[model samples]
Target: MPDGDRYPLAHRLYPYARSADQDRDAGGPAHHPVIVVGGGPVGLALALDLGLRGTPTLVLDDAEGIGEGSRALCFSKRTLEIADRLGCGAPMVEKGVKWQVGKVFHDTDLLYEFDLLPEAGHKAPAFVNLPQPDAERFLVERIRTAISDGAPIEIRGRNRVTALETSQPARLQVETPDGPYALTADYVVACDGARSPVRKMLDLDFEGRVFEDNFLIADVRMKAEFPTERWFWFAPHFKSGDSALLHKQPDDVWRIDFQLGWDIDRKAELSEDRVRARVDAMLGEGVDYDLVWTSIYTFQCRRMRKFRHGPVLFAGDAAHQVSPFGARGANSGIQDADNLGWKLDLVVRGAAPDSLLDTYAEEREAAADENILASTRSTDFITPKSKASRMFRDATLALAARHPFARAMVNSGRLSMPSIYDSYLSMPDALPDGPPATRPGAPCPDAPLGDGFLLEKLGSKFTLLAIGCAAPETGLAVVACEPTPELTARYLGAAPSALYLIRPDQHVAARWPMADAATVAAAHSHACGATT
Candidate 1:
């Protein structure tokens, strides 16, 4: 048993290196094509995506290793799919806790429990819970392996960005342990956390609402047989009239969050004695447990107006932030990397115009708005700022126990999901009366293909899938899938033959019943943000 800050978690420390010589041979001062600031999951994943696309990338971070404590412990299925595309999903899925059922309680009475995935046959689960440090370590291992395989991805830890210049080629003043150096990149991506120095240098502000209530989060290590599910309580016996959340994690560690009101002393509340008492009251005095880590935080649902600023682009918490209720912060940021990776790769290789980058901002900003709205509503329901809001929330919880309609109104954090890009880069077309899940602007549904999965065949390049029909010969990769009942139900509903043009990120660009080379090419061009 250790204190809050000194929990035993092993992380490999990456060594710092001078990247000046590597870039000098490429061109002028602009040596690296892309420089990713912050070696967190988002930055590392973005670098891996670009590296897989045959682009050289440089990643710089101030810290030597993955962060301590289980900061973010939930991973959505969409995020796992993105990780799977990047070659790190299997490890996470194998090591994480898979859960789809969640229970909501109203003061010692179980109100309702819901299952996220009612039907089976999907490739990925609804969600998985793993420590954030574990996920980051897995990404780092993948990056090192890719580098060993000559993917042109380099990571430099303890390299802090002191200042940034956002000109034609972005320049960063990096401070390392050895000395200070200047590195210039053709394009820079800021995956730095919420207090982003890059965003500050660009004079961008995060605008949104900040809730007054504070929360105490503790990770306790104990041998308890708690079921692997999410248990959320609104007004419980232990912490009467307050909201609490319980989640099971790996290694028999349980994460508990208690809602603390606005006017509380920070030091007194975080004391070891106070935390022990709270745990005793919740888990009972006889249960034995050790406090692994503890922290206090306030919720803020905020985002930058635009994610892209000139040659520097923002992702992850740097671009947007939300409360932990919905687990939207890291999930949406991973999706941002997934969306920007291919577009940036095409732009760097001169295959697509710079306008393609604007679509990333447009689509991710819309996603940010959606996440903020959901997180705000969840926070309001749980905390209830005003008396009337509390009344409405309690009433809904009471009615939810009896009426099925009220169950849908229970907002115990609408979990994160992939955003459907309806208005941004997807080409407008009428779906020919089929399953709407694989429509234009949506993620390509995963199906079992031969011995592998459908997503395994689509990413890293544009793919043209011809289902139950002959495909027109084109420059894009073609996947001709035979019509099976599972494939038809997920991909082709009522059509005998169909054509889908999928982007490098596995999102459906456009689909047609029958398409020629010209039509597919036009749709591909439109997906790349070409006006004509």
Candidate 2:
């Protein structure tokens, strides 16, 4: 027998302030360039990106602060890089549990351990374990700083959108603590969670396969010497469930997940005694711990057919969702913000046509598919239904303990990585012998330069990365770097010098061994979705 949790975590870091728009009665809805619905990590990230880019943006969150519990725990490296670009990565990285090593176990036996980021010379780690609320808080903090520095960003917390119309300038009927008022924006982005109110309001089809099993996410705080590493179990020795996950976070918080099968007592399973019993069993008899927050989830791998719906758009879980297996949930959503921010900024500023926004749908939808497939595969591996399949999985897990070849077959969870967009906006590579990592349509990998790194130089706009050569004048930001060993391996490959046309989102649009002014201009035009 065990006792229930004695500790409860505090939520809500941001305060709700009434907006003047809530009091407007007469004139049509107040108009802004862009408005984001949910103030979770994705929405805050999008608003922050747009704000730093000198675009006026507003965020309307149903809640005043970050959610309770550590909803999303794993933030990926690419996500950290994106956060760096948004000017808020330092605090998060500083405050997170930094680790790249993960170990898998079969029953009481250690299968194998793997390193996510084995190489050096990167700014961010493979992944960081931070509470989702803390991540969102950092974004909000950056938004406030940007505001003080004259970036037009405002967050009206508790200003929920009751209804919305997707006209040319989309109109939204917002409900605040004060009262209800209407407002409009040139573009509306919905970053609401999986059961998105915006998706419901529009009556859009959000389709995907839902797994039957349930998972209990328990965040516990205990004073113990647990290494900051990921530990996963298949048929855990504790005899709690079929599968389990244990991860560490900052502030002595540790997250545990037990996969409860489809057939279980919902009420009994969630009972305080039952939950505590499971926790006690996992930790063994004599560990003192307090449960901070606990949640049960029946995760699904699903997404909307299209992320863009005319004047309105969808990002984050509002657009797609996947099992928590791969830290793909928040990581992918932040990516949505990164993908959409610059494109939306271009369209709003008339620098790029509205059609450019369609590429956001195209690119992010592809990413969603990749995430869904990975999540589905992970779920299937973790909970094999058929007896023969289970046998195979068990054999594979056992063999992975010793054999290197069998380790590849073991799928604890395919971790999240940056999606290489086969985007329509990209111009094909002219040099056949270029580094594949820096090839056209791939997100630029970070490298060492002077005292700083390569990504720090990219900023958030179109730039020309000239290596061992003079950059052609395309009227864009250009950085000339002498080809060091790291640069040569990452960007040059067999070629001695190269010119890369980088998009505003830091994806390589095109790469050439050398380019003249005319060639550079043509590549820029094609990269911007401008066809002659």
- Which portions of model 1 miss their true places by more than 4 Å? 1-12, 18-30
Model 2, 1-532: lDDT tens digits are 1212322223455567766676667877689999999989999999999988888999888887776678888999999999999899998899889999999999999888989998888898889999887887788788888999999998887888999898887889988777788888999999988889999999996789988899888888898786889999999999888899999988887999999999877878877788889999999889988877777889889999999999899999999999999899999999999999998998899988888889899999999999999998988899887899889998998888889999898888899988888878777878677888878889998888999999999889989999989987668999898998888888999998999988878889998998998988888877776856
- Residue 14, model 1: lDDT of 83
Q: How far is candidate 2 from the true structure (C-alpha RMSD, Å)?
A: 2.2
TM-score of each: 0.96, 0.96
Per-candidate clashes, comma-separated: 0, 0
lDDT of 2: 0.88
Off by over 4 Å in 2: 1-14
Q: How far out, in Å, is residue 13 in model 1?
A: 2.3
lDDT of 1 at 197: 87
